[model samples]
Target: MQGQNGRGTDMPPAVSVRLEVIKRRSDFLKAARAQRRGMPGFLLQARRRASDEPDPSAIRVGFTCSRKVGNAVTRNRAKRRLRALAREILPQLGRPGWDYVLVGRPGATVTRDFAAMREDLIRALRRIHESPQ
Candidate 1:
C-alpha cells in the first residue's frame, strides 16, 4: 500500500514519521546546554522544549560541523552525512516535543561505517531518554 508521502509502506498510521528542521542558532545553543551523548562518529545533544513552545508535538533537529572538523568542503560533507542519517533514523526513534542536535566529528563521521553510526544514534537516544532531567 502507498503511504501519504507516496511511498509503499506497511507501518501503522499511529506512528509519526516527520521531523522538523531546527534553523535558529539559539535553539541549537539551548539543546547544547541540555544533555549530550558522545559516539565515535558524532555527538548527540537533546533537550525537551517547553510545553508552551510552538509545535511541541514535533521532533526538531539541527546538524553542525565546526571548522575543527575541516574546511568548508569537508564540513559540508560531514553535515550531509549527518542529515541523511537523521532523516533515516529520527522519524522512527525521535520523541516529540524534543530538539536534537547532531555534531559531526572529524575523520570518524566521514569514514565510519553507516551502520555503526545508526547504532550510535539509537544508543544515544536511548541513553538520553533514560537519563534524569
Candidate 2:
C-alpha cells in the first residue's frame, strides 16, 4: 500500500514528533506540575514549558528503577521494557507541551506483563490530558 508521501506502507510512518517531548528543562513548570498524575502499574510525572521554548523534535523519556525493583540487571530489564513501551505509545499519546517521567515500582513492575505495562502508560497519559484542573 502507498502512504501520504507516496512511500510504500512497508516503510515506517514518518513520525511527526514535537519538541515538548524532548526538551529537558523549560519554564512551563506549572503545566508540568498540573499534569503530574499516577496509576497503579506506574507513576506519571510531567512538566510543561513555555509554548515558544526551543526544543528538539524527538521523544525523550526518563525511567527510574530503584533497588526495590531489583539489582542492576533487573532494573535494566525493567527500564528496557519501559523504553520499548514508550517508543510505541509516546508518539501517539504524549502531549507536545509536556515532559514525562516514568518511575518503576518494585514487585509488580518487575514481573508485570509487557503489554499491560504499555497499556497502563497510554491510559495514564490519556487521563492526564483529558482532565482539566
lDDT of each: 0.88, 0.64
Instruction: Report the Cα lDDT for candidate 1.
Output: 0.88
The alpha-carbon deviation from the true structure for residue 15 of candidate 2, after best TM-score superposition, in angstroms, is 3.3
> What CA root-mean-square deviation does each model show from the true structure?
4.7, 5.9
Best by TM-score: 1
lDDT of 2 at 123: 74
Error of 2 at 2 (Å): 21
Q: Clashing residue pairs in candidate 2, if any? A: 28-48, 28-49, 32-46, 32-47, 32-48
Worst 10 residues of 1 by lDDT: 5-14
Q: Mark the regions of model 2 whose C-alpha exceeds 4 Å error after superposition.
A: 1-34, 56-59
Scanning candidate 2 in windows of ten residues, the lowest lDDT window is 19-28
Superposed by TM-score, candidate 2 places the C-alpha of residue 45 at a distance from the truth, in angstroms, of: 1.0
TM-score of 2: 0.70
lDDT of 1 by residue, 1-133 (tens): 5756443333233454688999999999999999999999999999999998999889999999998899999999999999998887788778899999999998998889987897788789889999998
